[model samples]
Structures are given as structure tokens and as C-alpha cells.
Target: MVPVAPTVLFLINEHIATEALLGEAFTDHGFDVETFEVVPAERAEDPAGHVTFPDPAGYDVIAPLGATWPVYEPALRDTWVGDEMQLMRDAAAGGTALLGVCFGGQLLAQTFGGSVARSPRPEIGWCEVTSDRSDIVPGGPWFQWHFDRWSLPPGATELARTADSSQAFVLGRALALQFHPEVDTELLKVWLAADSNGEALQAGITHDELLTRTEELAVDTAARVRRLVAGFLTYLAGQPRPS
Candidate 1:
């Protein structure tokens, strides 16, 4: 008999981004990965009530990726924000593991009774974190590009943090991460180039400098992502899957 591969859904959101290294890492770890976008392109500027997210059934993992929107905005909360949060809650209740990245992490925190707010100091480019579980979250510079941070949800364990905010947390099978473990030079190029109003410049990082650093760190970053996924899978192994 042949072993069947586990499936994962990568919620790419409305942004022009990919799972990049993160989705690839999961594939290397033997999981079938699928991509979904919650906000339709026509409604990118105002996604509220424009989309209905897919029901997460049969997938072993549901990973909500980064986005350009803030999770705390009241306008969003009334529409797709509430909708997606409900989806996350439903997936969690049904035993699908949740992995929320950046904005996704903030949303996960919000859904799980925590809060998301603008950080006193926003993080961009590659930033270092102090990890309580370094074997999983790691301590070295991980890619970050968000101005918001998540308050630890009830029953969630803090895995890593920085002075600005919580960097990573875990609750049951769910892993919420503030950093981008899947970022690579190409993806960063796509993102920075698409920043119409110069988001990186506003954050004090130049496009050339950031991409240069990414080139220097790409090798190590990929290794860290690989190890991070392995550690995460091992951690998930100990949790109960929905029957």
C-alpha cells in the first residue's frame, strides 16, 4: 500500500504574493499544498462582503498568509474579516491545523480572543527575535513587513518575541507567526516593487538595500524555513487530528 500525502490550503489572500519558500517547504515535507484567495481582485480595495472563503474540509493544514489590510479595522470586521475569522474558527473546531502568517497571525489572534493593534514600532526587512522555542521559531533575522502585532491569545504559548511585539505563538495545532518564513529574494522584489506608495521607504528600508540583504541571507533563510517546518510538523504530530 502507498502512503497518501496530507493536504494543506494556503490562503494567499488578496495580495500579490505567494507562499514562496513557505509553500515549497511544506511540499518538501510531503504535504500537498493548495492556494486560495479570500478577496476577489475587483474587491481588493474593499473586500468586505465580496468573498466567501472555501470551507476547510479534508485539508490537514490551513495557512492564512500575509495581506495589505489591517485586521483591527472596524469596516473589515463587519464583513469578510468576520467571515474569514468564522472560517478559521470552524476549521479549528473541525481539527484542521491553522498556520497564520503576519496579517493572518493577527487575524488568528483576534479570532481566538486576542487583539491586533498598531505596534509602537513597526518591523520591516529582516529582523531578529528572541525565541522561547528557538528550535521552532528561531532567533536569527526573519523577514517582517507589518505594522501591526498580535496580543497572545488565551491558552496560546508564546514561542518568540521582540521588543516591538509578540513574534510567534502556538495554541493547540495552530501556529501564528508575525515573521515571513517563506520570503525569498524574488518574492521580496515583487512585493517591494508593487508598493505603490513606497511602503519600504516609509519603513526606512530602501528597495536595493533590502533586496541586497535578502540575496545575502537567502541561503540561511531557506534553511531556517525548512527546519521551522520540520519542527512545526513534529509539534503538530503530538496534537489530535479531527476524526
Candidate 2:
């Protein structure tokens, strides 16, 4: 049978800048990607009101980007009501790939029987991740921007880590990343300027610091991200289903 084009769904909660950066990454990979920006009724509350689940049959992959976890998590859970956990459960079970970045990563874990809660320290600026599973993730420092962290769900493989938190997890064809490997210098500037992260800049973290670090990050990280995407695609390709 001829393979169908892989269709990917993107669930975005942050404003245009973040989603645009990530979308560019997806487009670069040659996947057919569709996106939705779930606007929360309250930035700090549940996003249940804005929750949306399009026909899963149409997409081979699903990606949820970073946002206020409080808002996105409830919405995703409430979208399924009694079977909230099954959102990811069913996806993984059916061989559909899921990639969650930062807040989205937390949601993926929470939906898959893991815990997502506030970290002891908020890792807001550029940082690094240690990779015990270097075959799956590149070692050394990776970028981070989260106040929360996740414990791996049962049967999940942890592909990346840092002193601060668990960085990445893989269950079947699905993967979740705590750090922002998708980020670049331009995106970094826009994110720093955004209201959601303005406090970090005002607290003496200058744009220059971020730009310099992200540039250093891009040097090695682009290859890592490409490898990760290819790895995930390989997993999806090996799935029982034909896509």
C-alpha cells in the first residue's frame, strides 16, 4: 500500500510567537501540520473551556506546546471527561505519535499516569540537560523554561535529564520534552518580550544573555532536534498501522 502523508496536529496555547517558531520546525520536517491556539478564559486557571479535540483519525501525530499548565491540563482532561487519561492512552495504544514541549510535556505525563507539579526551583532561563540515554538524546546542557517538572509515566523511557528535572520521556511512539529544544534566538527575543515571561527579563535576565546562550545552543542543538524528530518518525513508521 502506498503510504499516506503524515498529518500532524498542533495544540498551542501561547500567543503567535511561540507557536510560529514551533510550526516552522514542523514545516521544515515536511509533515502536514495543522494548528490551534487555545485561548484560556483566565491565564492562571483551567483551559477546559477552550479545549478541543479534532478527529484523531486525520492526524498521525499530535503536539501540544508550552503554556500555563493550569489552563491546558484541565482543558485536555476535561475534553475527555471520565476518561481523561485515555486521551494519551488511546493515542499511544493506537500508535499515534505525541510530542509535548514544556507545559505540554507535563500534560502528556499527567495524562499518562505520571505527576506534574511545581519544581523546587523554577528553571526559567537557558540551562542544560544531562543525557544518560545519549543514544536517544544528546548529552550536555539543553535549554529550559519551566516552573514545573514531570515524573515519567509507567513503562515510559526517560531519554533526557538535568540537575533540575526530568527532561524527556518516551512511551511507544510518543515523546515529551521538558526543555525548549525548538527555540532559536529570534524566538527567544519574542518570548522574553511576551507578558508570560516578562518577569524573567525584568528580574535582571537581559535579552543579550538569552541571545548569546541560544546561539551557543543552536550550534549543537539543531542536530539533536533533527535526530530526535527522525527517531520519533522512525518509531511511528514501525508502528502496526500504515500511515
Q: Which candidate wins on lDDT?
A: 1
Superposed on all Cα atoms, model 1 deviates from the true structure by an RMSD in Å of 1.5
Give one digit per residue, the lDDT tens place, for model 1 in 74-179.
8888887888899999999888888889988898999999999888877988888889887777789998998888888899999998778899999988999999
lDDT per residue for candidate 2 within 148-226, as digits (tens), equals 7888889988987878799888876778888876787777776666646465665457667877877877867777776
Model 1 pairs whose backbones collide: none
TM-score of 1: 0.95
Question: Cα lDDT for residue 151, model 2?
Answer: 80
lDDT of 2 at 154: 93
**Candidate 2's TM-score:** 0.81
> Model 2: which residue pairs collide?
128-141, 128-142, 129-142
